[model samples]
Target chain A: MFFKFKNKKITNMISIVPNNIIKFEDEAGQYNFPIKRTLKMMDIMGYKEHRLFNDSVILSDVAVYGLNYMFENNIINKEDIDALLFVSNCTDHIIPPTSNIIQGKLGLKTDMICLDIMQACAGFVVGLLQSFMLLDSGSVNKVVLINGGTMKSRVSKKDRNSWPLIGESCSITVIENGGNNDVFASVYMDGVNSNALIIPAGGFRMPSSEETGKLQTLEDGNERALDHLTMEGVGVFNFVQTVVPEELKKLMDYAKIYDKDIFAYLFHQPNKFMLEKLADKMGMERSKMPSNVVENFGNSDSGTIPLVTTYNYGSLFEQEEKTVCFSGFGAGLTCASIIMNFGKLENCKLIEYGKNR
Target chain B: MREKILEILQDLRPELDFTESNDFIEDGYLDSFDMVALVSNLDKTFCISILGEDIIPENFANLEAIENIVKKYK
Candidate 1:
């Protein structure tokens, strides 16, 4: 339910978002939902524009692009990356994990640990938790943690609930040892309610079929097929609102840290509206928390937190040390958070996926 | 109290006329995110704590309903 990791610092965080942008107003015509209501919903949902992958650009491409940037910039030595943990829900195929695919493409060493963990929204923190545990055992000195996916691939053009809210990007973080164990993390899940946000079909439980692929309208006046990732927007909003403030209090209590001591609170930017509400409920100052990453790059799921880190606070982190807190909730019907002292970043770059790769 | 609540909700969702409509949730004018935000600012404005159970639809259906719940703490 709750955990802590110390003696490891997130040395660097690199983010990549596809070049394409999908405007909400332009897509409203396809939904046929009243334009007035659609625009209102977009404002309320904190969506303006979201990024989508260029067909050729898979989640791995953007992630590998960020990785390659880090290497070329002399931010990280490719050989020092021993453990490669890729956390994602949307990949090229279900059989061979995306981690192996990335390792193979990058030509990583055969002896390195390469595996994929299927996770969404809260992935970055979960990946950090796993990476910290791996290196704590004294086997490896550095770990490359990636949390990304071709998440927009799950968005059905027919489903308004997921339509405009889907934002895509990739985040790769480097974690290394010999730092103060000041980092604290907590991860929670509600499996019984996992279907509150899920892809009902395409998995073995109910494989994708022609029947599932056929679109049908629902009570909410939106259309979706069983094969697409369906989300109960209200359910997820309520789940996060009710659980996260308490989770934050627990995390602070465990770490013996208080709000006054915190320099920043970076949440996985689900959306502008959601983050605004959560900040109000948590009794936090808007400036103390950066909630605009979703608006800047769309809700690139796992990539959101790192994007916020590099986009908003990258420069600040480069100058001085700050007690920072991170929280992400979604997809798994899961939530994870970390409280750490953000130190100088040897390399934290927000790179765009170029046309070539 | 209703006027003050209106002032707060308006800041969160300036797109709609909250004072003109009584059917907030049903009309899709207010959903979960708005409800949380409305309740939060109300809690702050009225100095009342809104528990999870108090977050039912009827409580947030209209301005009058929100005022009624806020009156409970007073």
Candidate 2:
């Protein structure tokens, strides 16, 4: 589906990553491949270091800390937010919505709508889509979209295919009902290929079991339990290179904006190789698309795009308005894109959360 | 068609000699990422859309396998 929204703008964004970091080179000995081969693979796959919290820390814990940071810095007022949207694969609990928990933890107003959106990499754009719709209703003036996941808690360290690339971080974005430009957005979902990226067990359909928890060496030589996150890497890579560029082109054509007009292509960073391939396929200038998020912070699920923007542009987003493309694709088997004159933010920060709290 | 397929493979990973190895995947000449890229290049070059189900490793194992895939789609 395609959408056009007027006057809904993302005014502030803050991406908070864990303080504890793990470098790929240091952990090369753990995988099935030889250390030398693994190190070579690391360079090929663009695995550098990833940020993850201790097992004790949950998504809400880091989200609370992030919200507190914004509150402390006066970047966002707690009372001003009319809606809270938490987009993540890692919710605090399956029953009580994490957004409501965050609201209660922060002591925010009860009257506001608090909802949890279950999504992965394509979440930021999906969250933005929801926020824009909320703002369009006129009842809501401000929406706080919290996107990220403690994905390391799910991916097994023994699974070399996914472990090194998974990073944990939370991004808090404030969207409001005041902008002068039109925003173009589109979403494409293929539930048929949902298995491309998934946790095979631990859900209601396939509840957690002792059998499911038992780690076994798979055909590919990676050891993983059914509960561990698995990826059909080629399927995902093919989906991105084929589907994403097509959808992005359609969005750009609809928006009537060319590559020259785009200030940046803030895509959800799967890794350096994939992003470069996507950029090459789209005929986009590689410089415009920032692919360093994976190497720096790993792929923070839904938060990666916001992490890309804040990590790359920083305060520049607050100083000037620029035409930018924001894309997030993966697990939901979802690909989404949003284009707008994005800038004039009160805060655009990338901070380490665990160091303090 | 074979020349086009080889050209696509060569363009995707210029370091690897596509003709030298019968099993590009097993020989480590092409990994999963390369397979996807190769599929994409073939799809674009031949103006044929290869469905996701047909993107298995065996279909992209070697030059003959890839050529067969392109022939089916074309």
Candidate 3:
């Protein structure tokens, strides 16, 4: 579907990644591939250092830390937040929505709307879409959209297919009304192929068990269990290379945005290879798209797009306004994009989790 | 078509010969990233839109499988 909002704007954004770092070389021994092939694959896929939260930490912990940073820095007033949209793959509990937990923990006002959006990969864009909708309704003046998760908690350590790619971070974006330009966004979902990327167990459909948790080598020669997150690499790659560019073109066409008009294509970074291929397929220069996020901090699921924004152009965003586009795709087999005149943020930066605290 | 497919594969990983393995994906001759690059190259080269469902490892396992996919799309 297509959506255009005239008054919604993202005024502040912050991405917080855990301090613990894991280098690809250190964990190279865990994969199915030989050392030589592993190194070669690393070079090709741009696998390097990634941030993972320790087991004791959950999504809300880092999110609260980020929120506290924003509150303490005077970047935003806690009382002004009209809504809280916590978009994440990992939840504090399957019962009480994590958004409410965050709301209660932060001691924010009770009048605000609190929602927990169960989404991954495309989450940042999806969250932005919901926030835009809320702002358009005029019920909310400012929405705090938090996107991120403890992705590693869902990925098996032995599953080389996903382990090295998992990173955890939380991004808090303040979306409010009274914007200058029109915001164009689109969402494409293919639920039929949702299993292409999924956690086969842990829900009521297939409850987690000792059997489900039992690790076995899969066809790809990677060890993972039904309880762990699994991805059909080729399936996802094909989907991205084939469908994403087309979706992007539709949004660009609707927004009347061309290659030269965009300052950056801030996309959810799965890895260097996929992003490079996507950029190539789109017939755009690789420079216009940043693909170093996965290499530097791993793919933090839905947090990647905002992570890319702050990591790459945080300083620039604080000073000027530029036409930018954001796209997020994965699990749910969901793909979404947003194009807008973005910048001059009161806060656009990436802060370490505990270091900021 | 076979020669063209081989050329695309070679360009992606010039170090490996495409003919030696019956299963390029299983033998590690081609990885997921390679498949993506190869698929895009094939789409551009053959003017065929290979659907996402047709991109499994089996379809791109060998030259014959790849050619069959291209043929079907054609």
Return the TM-scores of chain A for each candidate in numbered order.
Answer: 0.96, 0.98, 0.98
Q: Is the docking of candidate 3 incorrect, acceptable, medium or high quality?
A: incorrect
What 10-residue stretch in candidate 1 chain B is worst by lDDT? B47-56
* TM-score of decoy 3: 0.89
Candidate 2 regions exceeding 4 Å error are A355-357, B1-21, B24-60, B63-74
Which regions of candidate 3 are displaced past 4 Å?
A: B1-60, B63-74
Ranking by lDDT: 3, 2, 1
Candidate 1 TM-score versus the reference: 0.88
- What DockQ do you compute for every candidate structure? 0.20, 0.14, 0.20
Q: In CAPRI terms, where does candidate 2 land?
A: incorrect
- lDDT of each residue in A1-357, candidate 1, tens digit only: 777776878888878877788888788777746565566666555667878888777788777787887777788888888899988786768878888888888888787888788888888888989898999878888899888667655668867677777787888899889676578888888887888888888899999989988888886677888888788877787777788888889989999998898988888887766676677678878688887765556777777888888888777777777888988898778889999888687766677788433
TM-score of chain B of 1: 0.93
DockQ-derived CAPRI band for the predicted complex in model 1: incorrect
Which residue pairs collide in model 2, if any? Answer: none
Q: Write the per-residue lDDT of candidate 3 for residues A80-195, one digit (tens) a residue.
A: 99999999878898989999999999999999899999999999999999998888787799999999878776788887778888888889999989767899999999999999
For model 1, name the residue pairs that clash: A6-A181, A7-A181
**Candidate lDDT (C-alpha), each:** 0.79, 0.86, 0.87
